[model samples]
Target: MTYLKSAYKNAGIHHKMILLIIVLMLVNFAVFAVILKYIFHIYDNQMYKKTSEVLNISSIGIENELRNIEKTTFKVTTDEQLQRYLLQLESETSPYTKMVLRKKITNRLIAFAGSETYVYSMVVIDKEGQVMSAGNREGIPQELHSTLSELADEYDGSNAWYAAGHSSLVAARQFKSFTDSNFTLNGLGTLAIRVRIDRIVADRVQTSGRDGQLTITDGKRMIYPETPLLSESDMQAELARKQPYGIATYSGGTFFAAQVKSSYTGWTYLHMTSFDDMFRHITIIKEIVSTIFVIMLLIALALGTRLSGSITKPIVQLIQNMRKIEKGDLDRLEEEALGPVPFSTQDEVGLLHRTYKKMIRRIRELINENVAKQLLLRETELKALQAQINPHFLYNTLESVNWLAKANKQDRISEMVEALAFLLRSAVSFEEQLIPLRKELDIVRSYVTIQKTRFDERLIFQLDVPEELMDAQIPKLTLQPLVENAIHYALEPQIEPCRISIVARVREGSLFLRVEDDGPGIAEGFLEKLHSGQVTTRGQGIGLANIQERLHLIFGAPWGMELHSESGTGTSIHVCIPYVKGDQGHVQGAVG
Candidate 1:
């Protein structure tokens, strides 16, 4: 099975199409053959039924005729003249009187036989084998007289019909004295009626001029029309199979035969006909159908070759062009190789060819654009390298200003410049995003020093962070933003003294830090504006929103800042972050 599948897969479209057509044709032929066989079976059953019907009709007619013969036999045997004459013939020994009695009995037999057209002869035999006859010149065979008498005696006064010869039927009965009712069954002599059975069958049975022949069996022997297709014993064996009415092959399997047994006579009637003759037309039809199928198959093969060739030709050309492209000949794709037509149409093959051409053009354009972009990127990198010394220049300039303030005996100016330089360095540096809380506090203290010089003594700054949490890791410059917002929003707006406090501790495995201010608290909705980044910071630093974003970015969720501020009261901002020791081991489920 695997080999067949592999072979089919490797076969070209043309051969595969031919094979497919042939397979389909064979399958159709099989279905047609089955249907034809079923039709033949139906026709066969119809034939059997029709033959059985005809046989049944003929049997009925023959039975009626035999019944008439039986009635005639009964009338003759019970006749007072015939019965009395036969009894007297048994006792009388005078030749003249005996001859007279024989003549009278013969006349009576002739009278009885003349009433039926098919009765050939009628004869009576006494116990001593004296024969009296009528209706035919040839009488009963002398050799058959005793046999006929014995058969008649076995009937015991009832009519017993049997086939006499190839062409005749004999009904034999024993006659008794009708004068005494008690002696009615007593046997006196045998009376036999020889009937022309051929004449009776000829008038009664019709085969409609078909080749069908009839065979009658008396359960033991063939009875009529001497040339039987089967012997008596063979026919009896066939009948003994006991299918009363059905069709089957018989007569050495030469003919299809239907048989029906008569209920009245117990004889089986068969109608046999040659099988070839019976199914000749059906055979011819089958032959014609088979021939047509084969012719159609040949025509389909011729058509399939042309069809597969048309479909596969374009596909093969496209594959050839793709192979050229695979070999790096991007410009070698010819319009003719794409499809039969240079321009596209609505069909899928046409669409595929057009799309391939478009893709090739796009590839060339992108190659040129990518080269130009690469040149521009190299030039920009050189300029960026030239500008790398700017940060050091700014730091050196601030250090020079700080020393000049100290030399001028300007203490406040020197302190502010030193703090500004430190803040500048911390903001500009990008070495590590996470720093120890103690380092972040140093940066915050530097920012507060600069703000405190600006606010004088009105800014009351307090630091309440614990010593143990100083080693905890937090994002660099995180606390400076919140503390600056408090000074700008809480203290800078009022002339009176306002206090700002930075409180830090560990709670539920997280560092919770709050920057509280006691100035005129943030105005209504200003805290919202501040958190949404709508309110710009007055100081040169990242706002509270930026710090919240930075904390969230580093520690994921539940680790941002929350603001609590009300009008005429202090504003407090809570900053929550995951607790990590200075070595950077993280605490899980810590942020709240």
Candidate 2:
């Protein structure tokens, strides 16, 4: 309740109605008995800590399938071609070379007993005892020549589990020939394998249901999964109650068990359960929170004694309509909070005076839709700056025909109409969208003086540019559409003459410039339609994708343009800006 209105808004109204009726009846009986005692301590200590995290996640998936059957019994017992065909089939007195060294060691134990599924069989015995089995040798039942002398007198070549009298379990390993430790001959004979331990702990005791009772052991015996609640005196009173690794609570506490152990078959695992069928949902959430905490404590002491005299008159008219909504007059909260909330009853101070007049009509429709979306985004950015005004009236009629060709003295028609009126006043400039690399090299020297009076002497232009980068800052006509996409793709067609350079450097911290052009270049089907922008028509006035979209709309997304072409070795292009100068940094948004 807004923390009981900021802990009884400066207590006085009969000590804030008896501290809101003794803090809403002791915060509803101490948060309903601390949420039913934290859901009975998460269902009796998280159901034996989720059965020791499902027996340590089923002993990490049966120790990754018993370390892939101990890496397929150490790759068929360190196979030097199955140990030189089991040391030449132990001196083959030739029964057809001992049946071709037992068909090449049974085709390499048919790839570790045809790859896993709990690898039921894969034997390979040797040192003169010739045995070469593969998978499901009927999941190994008995006589491997009377347990090869009880597995070479209990040889510890590792993986030694043993059992296999039908209910499987035999992991065995015994292959000796460490290639001549004096032929270490007595036993290159047992790789038994079998493996079933109820199919390797059957899906982790099927997730601890049936009130548990899984078992494993290996601290000297009990491996097969014999049940009847682990018999022999309930497996010595459920592995003698008190846990060693994880869960515990014994029969006296109505059971819980858990355990785990494993570290690759040192086997312990345990499991158990019961505690009234594992917390029967914390005893059905303590009988639905003791019947909703005794029917919300008799409906909060019968609406706190019929809300003690109009609950301090709607919290003193909601503190004088929240001091007239904290003084920022919410448009006269529908005429001063509707004459002190005429919300004729229906609780919580009439839903706080109809949610304070629906929050002052959603704050006057979000302040008239944010002042009509900021005056329609400033009338769509001044109608896109009035479409760059009519190209400044064609640069004021090419500055009155370059002052009537310099009052008729006609010095080359007034320097080609003053370089076509400085390329029509920097192409109708919309307030220096970044300029000065000396007015973008005076609009690329008046667009190479009107493309050198129409390619006279087959056009040749070079600019090496660096009078301290003629006052750096770029993106105006970013080097006149890369010198008009290098005179419309390296000098129009190609009757030879086309050298156009334009350079400018400053490597790492950006600001490159390039442009180069020995002509006949960009053709591989229009340089893959100008690097896939699918370049539409216009070639010179503005095309290399409109000066690489005005160098990513005036130097923003890491500035732009980068076309280094090469057909007959020509087109260069570069551009890439971001050196920044004038108003030292802060553009980051002009993608148009």
lDDT comparing candidate 2 with the true structure: 0.69
Where does the lowest 10-residue lDDT sum fall in candidate 2? 583-592
Please report, in order, the local distance difference test score of every candidate based on alpha carbons: 0.80, 0.69
RMSD (Å) of each candidate, 1 decimal: 6.5, 36.7
Per-residue accuracy of model 2 over 44-119 as CA lDDT, tens digit each: 5666576677767876776677777777776777776777677677767888988888888887888768777777
Q: Give lDDT tens digits, candidate 1, residues 3-28.
A: 99999999987788889999998999
For model 2 the local lDDT of residue 310 reads: 74
User: How high is each candidate's TM-score?
Assistant: 0.70, 0.27
**CA deviation > 4 Å runs, candidate 1:** 1-64, 84-106, 125-146, 153-156, 165-167, 175-189, 196-214, 225-234, 242-251, 254-384, 400-415, 538-541, 584-592
Clash pairs (backbone) in predicted model 1 = none
